[model samples]
Target: MTIPTLEDSGQGTGTAGEARRLAVRGDLTMAHVGAIAGPLRAIPPAGHDLAIDLSGIDRIDTAGAWLIHRMVQDWGAAGVPARVENASPDADRLIAEVAANDRPVPCHVPRGNSALDQLVRIGNAVFVITENIGKILAFLGQTLIVLAQTLVGRRPLRWHAVIHQCEAIGVNALAIVGLLLFLVGIVVAQQGAVQLRQFGAEVFVVNLIGRGTFRELGLLLTAIMVAGRSASAFAAQIGSMKLNQEVDALETIGMSPIEVLVIPRVIAMAIMLLLLGFYGSVMAVIGGGLFCWVSLGIPPVSFIQRLQEATPLSDLVIGLVKAPVFGFIVALMGCYQGMQVTGNAESVGQRTTQAVVESIFIVIVLDAFFAVFFSALGYN
Candidate 1:
């Protein structure tokens, strides 16, 4: 790399060289960029072989390396064989890295096909549904296994937790459940009176209210409300435990989260939903009776007689039988989603919402199935 060069004094000229080649020198860095930039640009670029010596460079950095690179590119464009000599190994590596990374990245462009896009969305939705169903079944099996372990081993069901949960889910829920059912009952009786009066059948309002309240609306609405309230609560509590690593800590210590957390809620909901369903049905009946007595001039005693005569014991049995089943589905969905929650606050909130949605959906689907089954059995 022997090339004569002037000692740099921030002058943009290279050292005097044999006329056959141009040379570069000085600290080719950002700080000295202005001194070198003008002189380098002013040099003629011919489509011929060219050489430059960097041995005179006192120091170099990324900016200086880039500047040298840019000059070489310009010479290359003009068909000159640009050679950089005597650069430090570090400077050489930096320059090579920058050049390699300087190429433009390839981008993917989506095609415009509305039909294909819709098909893709439909396929994805089906896949997600199937995957969710599989997860729920797997979790249900795991819960049952844990329940058997509790029954067979020294670990027993946590009654204290179940009692507390029952109070929370049942006792605390009663007021709202009663109030809403009372309103529904009033609406039913009012509507039935209006429609039946036109047909000279106004006295049948008690029968209308009683049969619907006990057989379907009572337990169905109770389950929906529980799905909205307790399902989210279950998911949120377990999700928070998961987020805080408490669930993992329990697992690490060889304790079952399902036994400790899930079973109690499951038992509580199972017991409470039955009680709540019956209670909700009674409240609805009372509310409907009140409306019938007030508006239709029917005496309370007469309304009770009509209800007993028209609605059989089958309706009450149906509602009670569905309660535990609905509770089971709600608990399964809530606990499965909670267990799915990862160590993130966002996931906790997301799983809680998903739990509520899934619980409500499953309850409705089960109710539909029960309706069809009872119809097939000629029980309703």
Candidate 2:
């Protein structure tokens, strides 16, 4: 069983200056809440701005303060301002804290766009593209400067770093590149053989495989692999370093991060791509030969003879020429995007994806350009 309890009472009035004053009184607490309801209701409704004086208040709990808070809020909502003017330091603090906590947070509303807004967005996109192009070209210039320094013996090139990248970007990637091209070669040969068999010209499958592999498919496929693997790795690695503040630490210690990081990677890609492209072309031809021998009953010797005649040394040279260019573009694009990373894990992820996509796009565009240029020059 429990006994009911009530709070200490208080008074409120209109003063000589005709100021509406609500004098807080009694031990206002949660348990005695029922006692204050009549007094609170007794206070006259808004004749003027309400000034609450807390001087007479003996005690208060959060509930009592909130009751006072509610009186002020209700008065304010009714177009009358209410303030606690004579509260004790502690009472003032409680009121202030409650007020602070109860304050409404502002909501943000997105603005509706007009036609001008759409144009502004397009303008912003173009500006960003121009800015990105400027940065990439600046990075290219810096890479060339570093290369020049290496050639003139002004700066020691990190041969060790280059070798390590070659192992990673080139040697480790060989198996995948070879396997994909080999499967592609088998498919091409099988398809070509099936069609040519109608005219009793199945032996021409070797010519088709050799010409396609050497002229276009070999280097392009190898570059796509490098873009997917090595480019993403470059962006991720550098972006991680940026996130960790290691790039700043490098500058603090008097090191050029471009030379230390970018130079080796760029050089390694150029060298490794040449070897990888050649290796991929050879594997594709071998895969074609295997398919020819097994499925078409064309002898390996006949396949080889037709391949040598079908794809001349000039075609191989043209493909090899494109390899290092693709590699340089891949590495440069990767490093450029990596350097653009802000100090965040999300930025790292975004930059890495951008690096792979941009590198692949550029590689394909360059491949298309080469095809046009060679056709115009009668290289085929």
Candidate 3:
């Protein structure tokens, strides 16, 4: 039989300016001080007296003593009479430690071992900026190189790799994107219907569905999906390579790991994203059409016709254009994080998490850029 135990049993009470007693048990460690401080800080100034009954304290440490001293100083500063009662001999010895230190304590700062320290600090800062700038430049340069290689290959194009990438990015991801876009379409249509009915303009639901889904939802959903999928994949792949020393093996064999691994993954992702965008747009439109038919009595043919009339060719162009850029970013970010993976499983997990977060950030920022750019170009 198992029974749950109560965690805390301390009680405090009664009247202004009266001493309140606290029963502290278990280990008298720094962690214990933290727990005690939470309730102690909340006590009113009128009844600010605190007494720690440490008779139940089985083990005490230096951190516990330091905490007590700080608390005493704080109460003294606040004009609250704080006293220690029932301190064990060990606790008394710890309290004596602070009293015996008479000299003015120096501030806690460590001086470095000379010129190399300064050089190392400066070099580290420079190296960080240089490395980040280099990553952007390298990513762009590598992207262009990969695209050019695909476009102007003297040998036949590697249809096999491209096909595999398509399967990974597009086919495997279809269910998730479709389901989400369908839900998005339903929500957008429902919201549009409510407001449209107010103005007796429910027929315009078709326009809302077409413009919103085709132009924004399609691109946004595709980007978010790809970012999570590809960025995580990259981090995991690179982290595994780092952990298993596969990257080192490649270097030893005089092969560029970037050219071999990064390029293929990026290319695959880019191609897959574009296809996913197209697929998402179709699914969203279908979902919105279903909503229109059910809620607004609009037939599918009329909805399509309304979408054709309300959404311009340029909107389609804008949506399609965002996909490739989003794809490139997703792929690049994944590869970058993968390459940045460190030597341990924990580090791999950390970098993978970082990659997902960073990729999503980059995607949103770039989407804002595209939104502004297209607006300026009269394409929105």
Kindly report which residue stretches of model 1 are placed more than 4 angstroms away from their true locations once superposed: 1-110, 151-154
Regarding lDDT, does 1 or 3 come out ahead? Answer: 1
lDDT string, candidate 2, 1-380, tens digits: 12222332233344444556666666777777567666675665566577777776777778878888888888888887778877788887897788789966769866777788999999999999999889889999998898889779898899999999999998899889999999989988989988998999987888899888997998999999999999999999988888888989999999889889998999899999989998998899999999999998889888888888888888899999999999999999889888899957999899999999999999999999999999899997
lDDT by residue (152-201, candidate 1, tens digit) is 87578888999999999999999999999999999999999999999999
Lowest-lDDT window of 10 residues in candidate 1?
1-10
Model 1: lDDT of residue 349: 91
- Candidate 3: stretches off by over 4 Å: 1-134, 146-150, 154-159
lDDT of 1 at 118: 95
- TM-score of each candidate structure, all chains considered together: 0.72, 0.73, 0.65
**Candidate number that wins on lDDT, 1 or 2:** 2
Select the stronger candidate by TM-score from 2 and 3: 2
Tell me the lDDT of candidate 2: 0.86
lDDT, candidate 1, residue 18?
24
* Model 3's TM-score against the true structure: 0.65
Candidate 2 Cα misplacement greater than 4 A, ranges? 1-114, 197-200
> For this target, which candidate reaches the highest lDDT against the unseen true structure?
2
